[model samples]
Target: MSLDLTLCPDCGAPAEVEWRAVMESTDGPVEHARVRCLRGHWYLLPVASLAGPGCRLAQSPTSFRE
Candidate 1:
């Protein structure tokens, strides 16, 4: 399935969403999508609300420093 993206929150331009991966869990399946704006800004979408229509920003774990 394809992702339905809204207007970019960063540039107010149209954004495109591409499916990246899906994590299977006992609770259910979680879908992940990559969103990119026309200006080339990228963001990771963590869809905890899989069965619904919502998502949250996901920061890369590897980007953290101790």
Candidate 2:
């Protein structure tokens, strides 16, 4: 399992990745991650999960509004 570095909005702590999915998009491939922070704040974050690209996660252009 990998760690999602997104800090909780309510608290300052790294979040835990619960699940991940890669979807094909017109822009390219996008990865969605379901995370829960140390404070138990749950949210969905769009990140670049592509391997051998960058060491850090990049936010998606379109936020997961749903």
Candidate 3:
């Protein structure tokens, strides 16, 4: 994983990534991260946004079931 930092939308605290994976979405495969902030706020964030410019989702051989 990249050494990128995500901020909590609610408290503006630094958020920690708990889990990350590419999931199937209506638009196609999208990378998402489960994150929690120092303030204990939890939320889901799109990996692409945190990945910086020119970031792309890698294709995963393993499929995920909802």
- Best lDDT among the predictions, by candidate number: 3
Model 1 residue 7 lDDT score: 42
Candidate 1 lDDT tens digits, 1-66? 544554455765455565567867687887776777767887766644222333221222122222
Candidates 1 and 2: which is better by TM-score? Answer: 2
TM-score of 1: 0.45
lDDT of 3: 0.61
Candidate with more favorable, higher TM-score: 2 or 3: 3
Model 3 alpha-carbon miss at residue 35, Å: 0.8
Residues 1-66 of candidate 3 have per-residue lDDT tens digits of 553456565766566667888999899999899878778888787776553432221122121111
Give the per-residue lDDT of model 2 (tens digit) for 1-66.
434355444554555567888877799888887877767788765754322223223242122222
Question: What range of 10 consecutive residues in model 2 has the weakest lDDT sum?
Answer: 49-58
Name model 2 segments beyond 4 Å from true: 1-6, 24-26, 49-66
Best candidate, TM-score-wise? 3
Deviation (Å) of 20 in candidate 3: 0.6
Can you list the residue pairs that collide in candidate 3?
none
